[model samples]
Target: MNPPIDDRKEYSNNFLSTNSPIYERFSQHTPRCHRGFDLRVWLNNEKNLTRTTCFCPPSFYGDMCQYQNQRISLTIQFRVLSDSWSTLFAIIVSLIDHSKQRIIHSYEQFTYL
Candidate 1:
């Protein structure tokens, strides 16, 4: 009996020429995803493969895996004392939780002049 032929090339070509806004690329550094396949073996096997949506970083989120995930924003400000050489700084880290509420983690420090 003959083995089933792989039609991934044709499927990929068709996907690329489609009017869909999604773009596909293959990379070995795809981030961890519960729904993704284990590619450790595939990575060690071949390097002559075409690009596909199977590999995408965690910073990206989408059906076709083209959109970028929103990231937590961090801001830091430093001020110097006029009388002495002490430094005053404030660090603020803000992350949006799954419930759409803002969660902030802040650290402030100052040196005695």
Candidate 2:
């Protein structure tokens, strides 16, 4: 069987025309929406302006996404022995239920070297 030819393509801005909007970059800096995206602003032509809506994440809610939802944060730290300096470790941390059977509610794993 004959071998197929392989063609490799390099990325470039040559595909865009000289008059494209990619050249004339706008400098309008919009305010951030805390955790989410696009705080939309509406401005009537000859009337009033400054109407906006902040699209916030599920963890936050407010007119300007200024409120934060309640959450629990946990931090874990580990130390390695001098004898096993080059050893790689897979660490699993779990949350268990209080019962006769050790029911695991949640778990997270971390790789250490």
Q: Please report how far candidate 2 places residue 66 from its true position, in Å.
A: 4.0
Candidate 1 residue runs with Cα over 4 Å from true position: 1-53, 57-67, 71-82, 98-113
lDDT of 1 at 46: 62
Candidate 2 residue pairs that clash: none
Best by lDDT: 2
Model 1 scores a TM of 0.27
Error of 2 at 41 (Å): 3.4
Please, what is the whole-model Cα lDDT of each candidate in the order they appear?
0.50, 0.70
Q: Can you give the lDDT of residue 58 in candidate 2?
A: 89
Find the number of clashing residue pairs for candidate 2: 0
Q: Each model's TM-score? A: 0.27, 0.32
Q: Taking the tens digit of each residue's C-alpha lDDT, what string does model 2 give over 1-113?
A: 63433322222345655576755443345566677665556677677675667788889988767899765677867687888899887888788868999899888898988
